[model samples]
Target: MEGFTLILLYLALPSLLFSAVKQILTWRKSLGSKPQFPGPRQFPLLGRVHDLPRYSLWLKFKEWADIYGPIYYTRVIDQTFIIVSDEKIAEELLVKRGHIYSGRPQIRSLIRHKEGPTYSALMDRHDIWKAQRKWAHAAVAEAYKHHFYGHVEREMRRYLGLLLLDPSRFLDYTREYCGRVMSRLAWDDATQGRANGDSADTTLHCMSVSGPITNTITPLWHLPAFANPWYRYEVRREREQRDWWLSNFRLAKDRMRRGELPGDTWAYRYFEQVKKEGNGDLNQTEEQEVFASCMIGFLNLVGVVTISGPLKFFLMAMGLHPEWQKKAQAEIDKVCGGRMPTIQDYAALPTVRACMKETVRWRSGVPLGVPHQAERDDEYRGVKIKKGTVVLACEWALNRVPSRYPDGDHFRPERWLEPGWPTYQEPLTRYPNFREGQAMHSFGWGRRTCLGQNLVDDETFVFAAAVLWAFDLAPKVCPRTGEPIPIDTQATNSHVILEPSPYKLDIKVRNAERGGQVLEGYREVMGELRL
Candidate 1:
């Protein structure tokens, strides 16, 4: 018995000693090699997880930026994060070093499901992501060349008419307009029927469910499946979402088989590409996956929700600051001459464009741009950033840099106008002769920049311009008090996409004749398109 006890002790001793040594080394590393960047004090093991705000996380991050400067480090659980609030540093890391920094963090909850691969934007830097991005960019560029803006213009007219009919349902109209336009861009036939009705709702639900869950409790992803029921639920939800997208794909495929393929639609283009090029380097499943992914991705993530927030914000801006609305309307009237605002008038309506720019800058839908993961261990400004560290381009902080945007919290369109105005440019790149600065980070930076930015910009400008041309948007008056209800610019729903909270706004046509003109324009556009 004594010999056996000794043998057991001998075996356990070495293993325990090894673990002790390893832990000591880890502790020393943690203690000796502290992060160079300043941040809130971190508790041992937990880091700043408890310090994080459950609601309005972006605002909290912005607050931290003010305290810790533009670049700071924080850890939640075992994951390290490098938050960048400055544009120059963001550009350096996310753009110039994009090859290494564009990798996406693994949110196991988001990708554990079978359909996870379909989320092209959330995908890690890999061959699959490259292929999906290539195909998506091509599809969007093709749609642009095919006069997709014409589709947007037509939809804006219809949207304006819907608002005129029921001003109270402006939110629904905005969301529905986005869905209808996306459906037209994705599947031309689907836009004419019931397909457009529930898509926006479905998309909103999917995002609302998945986004918060995936972002808030990412550490749970490390637990075994049996240990975490939430993981199982999300996986099931994702499967349903995958099925929805597949169903749409099948609808498009069936249409193709019957020789009813719609011209210039993304689905049609994809079908032809597969038939002609034989899926290129990808297998049939991958090809189908890419097609289905791009279709759903663009329709939901980019096409629908991305623009809805900005549209809502634009309306809120109009209601909150009637002066800016009047300025924009004047510009629209000058360029469009009482006719419906068109893309052709874009170059002439600088003030209208400036207003659009200011809306994006003031309250970006995506305040904290999507997280980018470090591909390899790197350093910035003498601060170490380990491989797999989550990098956040904190747009909420970046856009409100005090020097660039005075009274940054205030909604001011004039800041984007002449003389001392910021040099507003697309793609967020600096250029010579552009004086003040640029406000482009709302979309994102570098290789991970929003592929649909041009579409968003063009559509937003056109929609905003048309609405300003057609209506005098104002705050709703209280029937009891007879006082105008204050528009709370800060009253926004907390989500990955910050949307304007439900607010009452009185939307009226500038003139009764203008309402008739809008309806007539919608009829004429529909007739011309044979919709």
Candidate 2:
């Protein structure tokens, strides 16, 4: 009887000890004694869903940042959002700990046809994402090293010609210019035919329609087509977009097969590599999807929205502030003499660069930056962030931090030239040589920083310099009142991009002779290249 009792006690002791250790580990994994980060009051279950603004959500988040400090948590329904407005905290989490914070939240709208996965900017950080990014970065770098600037220069010349012919339709010209450049790079179609434009327009329209619907009724995406008409519509649009993309890939492949591959464009290079490597991870269908996804990423996601938004704002700025325009023009004239501004003139046109930087800082198209997801539970300072929590770097708020940017609200290009200007020095460094001022957050932060920054900087500088060198942008005169049209700086349209509301501006050629010289240069370049 004593032996049996001893055996029972020993077995019970082992079970008890195992249970005790499990509990301790669970406690450590839990929130424990961490203090709740300050934020707008949340209600039961629904959280702060009711409190969030529909339009200009970034502005509301900024207001909360003012009250709650830089790092604050907001819960919307079951979704946890950690907004980081402070640059240092952003750098620490997004850069230093990028391995954990680089994950992207599941946006159902972006997952076309509920397919396995597509490699686009919208994809979360994963093995496939890593592969896609590696290939994209390499491809873009190669393109840049080759003749990317030549493509840009040709497009810009075409843009200048269009602007000269119809200055009143400047926005249309800008959109077309961006579209053509991106389409040419992606598909090797410099003409930017109806098909390219239609594909881009369709993708944009689908995003515009589906983005808000998905946010409002996320669960609806999982429902059967019979249950939700909206989901049905979304799925149908996704199929259409996919078909269009696949068709383009097929066309490119056919061209490659015929040995008539258009210039060593992005798609041409991608197809060439596919033939060379024959990567086993991707089948023919998957390869097509990846190619199409990249095209959509560059053309619709990065190119059309970002490029056009800033160009509009720059034009508006020039119209509103002629003195700065004059300053930029003076620098351009001093640097380029009679020729149109080139990439070579970038260093000499510091004031023009300042204006470009200021335009980006003043009103970024992507005010909230892209959302990143937490891969696991983590703590920042004293606050707890759970796995899958959505993190926004809050570019709108960070750019306006008064402590870092003195007179942050005002648009002053000279501030970039002043001493001790705040600079970004965390995960990545931009404009290292520009010691006078801090770099702008327009491109974004950490590993998710814009891949096209180098291209954009060169393109924007050339565009701004050429425009300023040739034209004087001024407010259009009111027909009835014969007075200058009042421009409202605050008026903006918040879509995927933050665009200034339609406003009237007059673009007059500074010198007819200079404008003719620009056209002549365009003709000469085109003639020489036989483009």
Candidate 3:
């Protein structure tokens, strides 16, 4: 609140009020002519914003879906939004007609550099987005598969080592583990990786919430730097973030030059490919450098936030439903024999894989996934949708649609393992894969789907399997109450990513023999994979 800014706002307030009223009148005039989409009652100016709950927003959307029949309309102020909770409609619009629905809401806070937009997620559908995305995908394609698996396994082993050092820090260790692993995957960083991760988490969290202005409104970003403290803070953070990641970018490039990092490392290989794609002259342009850094930066954000989410949920699932945990461990033991589980055992341990997928399905990372903007006017099921309407694929509601998954409340892995359930598929080895964008709608849809899901799948599965194999999870017992604390599945995270509320896990080695084997196996692998 600045004196000059306030004076200007007040001066324009009367005209702004007039425009708002005019917009409302126009909307009301058209209400009767168009097929009114079923949804909560909209107010005079606030739309449905007044009724929106502060937490568990997906639940509220699901409740509305139940009342309004899958598709519904809601608005915040003058901005209209379509909440699509039905898989078929979501698929039809977000996937089938993706060309019209792949655009993202252009938030004013995120800036564009020479390479492209600050973040790929915020960039609307275009050639630059498509090209950057193509390179992103190619960076993780077949040539990099073996390196990907190795990165996952090596990092998982280190995570388990830290867990052995202190079991009480499961949540902290999981978060750090993801940060370190993604950093390694991003740029082969053995130094200052954690710092890079911290900056990424903070930077993306700001991006997701649009920084301090999110709590206020978008107009705050329009104020002069001296007039807006939030804008000043954002500018400061962006400069720091750019410098931090640019250093990592240079380090990875240096490592490649000095032959310190393996040729197979993601950082090494990706840069080489980019150079090849640019016809052997990288030019080292501002766009090239920033694009390279942000590619890795985005990876850091995605892995540290979203990847940690499912693991937290998996831990919670084990506490709430120990039966599935037992089955998973039993499968791991059978598959690995006496040795500790490895990525190679991934296929053989279908129950272990099922547990991981079930937790993700049971509790999606982003319940109301990244919003997609309607690029043009469209109609669906006889209801007209206006161009520029923000469309959200309600993943939570879609996954819990009674007809699709009847046992939605429980953490049951059998749905993925056995037939007769809608989620089931043949060949247990590959059926639960998260890379199938068409089959798995939790991540995202069509052209805008999350990249590097293979990284998430392989890395997360290895860690989840290792945790299940190495330890037994139960709700921590309260000494004073003399009862095990009840695990609340409804606990949630406030950020864009959805994870279980922090809870202490009662973890223990299944047996002394297996515990020793776990440590010994990790030591051997650590020796081989030490960077």
Candidate 4:
């Protein structure tokens, strides 16, 4: 009887294990028998979900891209995602075949308005999106043609004023300066009436924090409330903030209707147009649709919202590497002599431009960037790609690839001066200037690339050059240990944006007399602009 039992147990165990293996193979076969991308093999129901990295997903994507080529699919649970890391593949899918690849996937939040449609980042690709993009294009183009220079001048003056006033408040000064600059561009003034009765600076304060919360914490909002309690609070806070922003939107719309075009706010202009149309050119359906989709605050806020991460990253990079700052400052000083750097100064200040370019390359503010969704079925390198696939481009990985930048990890601006760079040999682009030959996808690739890249380009140069000229930065030393406090160039806070972990530094005035130069210089310029 014991012998019989042992033989029976062995037979049953083998059969059970075989069944499990067969079940997994059957599941894979059921998932569209087309050649599966060479990903970590899946379990019966789990797929390759467990293989995904929890954070720093871009790193994992780069690893996978190397093993599986540019357009490969990985499944999480049952959902499959495609990663497009190669420039040529991204261009083909995100640009050439964009009409099919342009549609963003339908996330739960996009369709949450049970009764009526909702306004969200994940709206469908339709006429509304086209119109919204058109409005944004027109608004930015207008600013470029007539108002961008004025905003740039005002920003330069503000930066100088803040630096001159108290360099101790450098962080605050930088934040406020950037906020006010975008505020003027979007709202025509730095009043920040969005804060209700709060201080004029409140809007800027909100602008500063919003970037981190949205860019880093937003993904966490997807976790189940029970599994991740932090998301529960984030959802509550996000709702409250959304309500607050909506109220401000309504107020701004009202003021624009009253013909109170204060400074150079793009919202005021867009709002004025919506009111003038008065449901005539567009029907009630169109009016509400347009309003819901392309409200001025909704559109213009994206500009201010995206700026903080890139700007902060730029500041921290300059602060950490004083040598790079010194070189850039020297170049600017040589070119401008006593004058401030301007758009024309771009050609003469290659080192300064290289610093900006290297900053973007070294640590892209938005490392993974906003994900792009494929609209239809496609093939990449003869492999089948299904419709409605979500694709991510690893700009961080692209920038740091050993092949592209030989010693990929170091922060060396002189690398750009290497024999082959600035020649457009690589299919990928760099930042500040984006032509076919001089492509920089830091803003992004294809149609939906960042609209505010131009604005950011102007602001980044001015701020970096001006701050370095005014201050000499070094790492703060530990009093007891006699060692420098370690700084994190990569200690990123991931929200909808990425920011370096806040760290300490010792900054001395470059010239004792010029301590107030940033502010004093601004006052003089502001005096002229006020008239």
lDDT by residue (tens digit), candidate 2, 1-531: 223434333434544355446545745776456587888886654567666765677888899999999998887655678998998888899889888887777665555411223435667665655666677777776776764747677777777766777899887777677767776777666555334544544554444422435453344444455644555776676676666666666676677677776765677777767667875232476765655555444443356566777888899988888899999898888878887887777667777877877887887777877777888988888777878888888988998888776777878887665556664332222342222236545666677766676667766777788888878899999999999999887566655466677888898878889789768766765653323
Alpha-carbon RMSD to native, per candidate: 7.6, 11.2, 3.3, 8.9
Colliding pairs, model 2: none
Candidate that beats the other on TM-score, 2 or 4, i.e. the better one: 2
In candidate 1, what are the lDDT values of residues 294-356, reduced to their tens digit?
Answer: 555444445776788888998888888888888888877776786998877766777777777
Please name the candidate that would achieve the greatest TM-score relative to the true structure: 3
TM-scores of the candidates in the order shown: 0.86, 0.84, 0.90, 0.78
If candidate 3 were superposed on the true structure by all CA atoms, what would the RMSD be? 3.3
Candidate 1: global Cα-lDDT? Answer: 0.71
Candidate 4: list runs displaced more than 4 Å. Answer: 1-33, 48-51, 106-121, 147-149, 160-169, 193-246, 257-259, 275-294, 415-418, 422-437, 522-531
- What global local distance difference test value does model 4 have? 0.58
Worst 10-residue lDDT window, candidate 1: 427-436
Local distance difference test, per candidate?
0.71, 0.68, 0.73, 0.58
lDDT of 4 by residue, 282-322 (tens): 22354453354334544445555455556666667777787
How well does candidate 3 score on lDDT at residue 517?
69
lDDT of 3 by residue, 1-531 (tens): 443546545544554476488677877878767786888888875677656664677888899998998888987656788998888888899999998998887554555432354567667877767766786778777534674747666777766766776888898778777777777667766434456556655764565542344332444455557656756777788778777777778778777667676665557767787667763534487767876777666656666777877888888888778788888878887787676577777678888778888888888888887889989998887888878898998888887887788778767788888988887887887777777622478778888888768777777778888888788888899989979887677787545676678787788878888678667766865766433
Question: Could you tell me the lDDT of residue 316 within candidate 1?
Answer: 88
Candidate number that wins on TM-score, 1 or 4 = 1
Backbone atom clashes (below 3 Å) for every candidate: 0, 0, 0, 21
